[model samples]
Target: MKGNPSLAVFGDWDADGIISSSVIINAQRHGMIYPIRGQAIIEYEPAEPVYLSIRLDEIGCFDAIAILDVPVIDRLLESMRSYRARCPSSRIIYIDHHISTHEKIEDLYGVVEEPLVGYVPTSRIAFDRVVSLGYRPGDRLKLFVDAVDLMDRGAMVPENMKGLLKIVSSISKALSYKRDPALWRSAVDWISSPVPLSSPIAGASMEEIARLAAESEKRIRDEANILAISAQKLGVFRYIDARRRWMDRGASALASMLYRKLRAPVILCVASRDRRHVLMIIKYPGKAYRVVKMLMETGIAVSIGGHSSLGIARIPVERIYDALEMLRSSAIY
Candidate 1:
């Protein structure tokens, strides 16, 4: 293209997002990857994927961009269209594992797309993509990817999965607080090398994660017992108010704890953080592909997306009870 082309890389704040962006960045840095229509190699910067939706006006400056691990495809269409109009030849690549409807993908044209939209983690997809392009990351990186996938998918076997999850949890808990983009980059770089999982590169991250995990676990242990006695049950689902003495830990960890303690096929945790808004996290078994569609059909949720096992949504505070009732009766799950 013109001078050194700018390529903005947007990824979510999860381990999958961090690794996905890292793979592309490492490949580009080693001259193993290049832009589609540029003579000079591309220079990229990492950004939170939500920025593209909230700050659409700033997208035109980049000659090429890659989005990783972030789903909300409908929110991105307008910005992608704007950028495409501004720079007709610019490249747009989107890679995600969130299940998206076919209609959403059809709205965009001329964008390079690789959406697994399955149970697979985005990091695995990134790994395969990089390998297809002839870049081979070390085995440690593969182990790191498998750890994240197993943890996310709630795999509890093979013995080593538990230890691997502890390491991933330490990194996740540390990242959840500050979420400095540099920390994610450092994690990618560290795992890309020969460092073992127990290396001191993590510093006190494991201790911090343990503290947070313990607090959350204790809360769940206490409250889940109360919920089992009090919560209304519909079929195999249990509806629990998640606000009671709940710590501000990560949602995945909380969901996992709730599943183990409650022993329910589905656990819907509803919390009204403020009088103006209500937040909910639904942890369910099987593929919940129709849950979002059914929830939005009720005109209750503002937004919702995640894996089939876990989902997060926002609603009006006044409608919390109504939303719960709707969810109970909908039978979408």
Candidate 2:
């Protein structure tokens, strides 16, 4: 490793991604994995195909690139290969716990660390990795990482940490609704700073997050009611077409809300903004990947990803009905 190496950090747009990126940044600041000389070029959720290439070009080259919590999709793999060809010496480390990444681990062997199987969040993975490499996080970052991990897994926070969890959830909801890269970056910086996770961080302030969460909750509550009323029962699975709703912004939250309301497995079919494809967000107790596999095997899904209890699949809009039928008939669930 070179002394004072330049670095590039990329993370998914969610709270897990933001907090995981912060772990890496904190490690670099402490001169742990690599002695980072300058501020790393941090980016969140680089847009696919178009923006990815443009962003890579803008980043030029770095001595190392750290990718956290981002799924290893085909398009992203292609872009990473192109970047590698252009900068052969730039070491790239991808850390993710998505079942999609786990399925493709062989192809991504050298670049990706062995993903922790099941519900572990990428922030926990990143923190553990840095710790194994001799980087110890402070009390605040550790608590924040715990909050992110529990929240990502849809688990309840301890009563003592409920306040911290609320702050984290508020920020996550704000980011989901706002979809602002600057806010994401601000969140990473906030988590990396010495400010306690319980304290209201500036830039991505508590007031702003609260306002966004409130607005998002209002719309999501209305949409949830609609989904509850119209959700189709397919065997043991409940399916709802969320294409016409304003759900692209809060799809995750909406799915979670519906899951709780239905008290059974729910699948949401949300259309992409560009209408390029439909996203199937599956919320199941423990077999979400089974649903994704069935979709892939039936050729209903073009791409499949996500966790054991929550899965995401992309399929052609024309085959949405076919997918519903297959899930309706499948015995896997």
Candidate 3:
């Protein structure tokens, strides 16, 4: 309730998350949200177990904090508690749409002032929440949110499609190819600008995004081609062991392609960079949550998160065989 409050904005390191953070920031800049005197914009990788990039102690204190498109994980819960204890009066607003977070909504309420977790894209949810505060967004911002909604929802667009849809897809693919915090921040700045539709995703120009998208598509195709040959049919799912391959990036795209090619659910397992954990990317037709729940219940997955038809799990590298056997016996068709 201060005259000019300081705010901190944290978003996941993805197109949807970046755009969602932009929606709130743009609202504040236009006097739609509170008139903030100062702010911090930080992007984080939600898939990681720990958010080492964010230093709560260094941030000092804030009037409010808005977390966008980030899942509710154990480490995040601990961090939020620490921040809450440090600044008891600070308002915290957490918003996300991942199924994993939705299942733990009760826990979220204990840490943040407002937890806007739902089934739609976080960009749309953020836009709607801002609108509910009696501020109308511009046509460009609305269009930008719609584009992110499509991308986050896994809407299929034709490869030759032209115009905004194609441009949005290219930007999403480019973001998926690499994890660049600077690039993500640039995207947020671009989205918050006046002529967002006219501008590229900040650090990367349109031509550069196109080049990255092309390269990403090729790498996905190459990885899928190799994995397809070694894919194992386990019960109703097609499992691929990707331990020998480096696929920290573009795992989602690779899984989607394999899903379409195999005409069945696809599970790709890749070892972490440190080789301490196994990352399982599951592209199930409609039972991704069930699969993830099973893994968690069986005590095989250390962390699990994602959407309805897509899920990601982290397990110890040694438990890979146990996870596969559990899935094989569950008959999760």
Q: TM-score for model 3?
A: 0.90
Q: How many residue-pair clashes does candidate 2 contain?
A: 0
The top-ranked prediction according to TM-score is 3
TM-score of each: 0.77, 0.89, 0.90
lDDT of 2 at 148: 84
Candidate 2: list runs displaced more than 4 Å.
1-4, 35-54, 110-119, 153-156, 196-200
Model 1: per-residue lDDT, tens digit, 86-147? 77766677777775523355554344444334357877877777777667766767777888
- Report the C-alpha displacement of residue 59, candidate 1, in angstroms: 4.8
Model 3 regions more than 4 Å off: 1-4, 32-49, 52-54, 152-162, 200-202
Clashes per prediction?
A: 0, 0, 0
In the range 1-333, model 2's lDDT, one tens digit per residue, is 545557777777777888888888888775455324454544344232334545665667777777777777766667777777788878778788887777777777644333333347888988887787666878888998999877766686689889878777777777777788778777777888766555556575678888997887777888898889999888888888878875355676688799999998998988777687898899996898788878987788988877778788889888988988888887864
Error of 3 at 224 (Å): 0.7
- In Å, residue 21's CA in model 2 sits off its true spot by 0.7
Residue-wise lDDT of candidate 3 within 142-222, one digit each (tens)?
877887776665676545333766666776777788767676677677877767476666567889888987888888888
* Cα distance off (Å), candidate 2, residue 60: 1.6
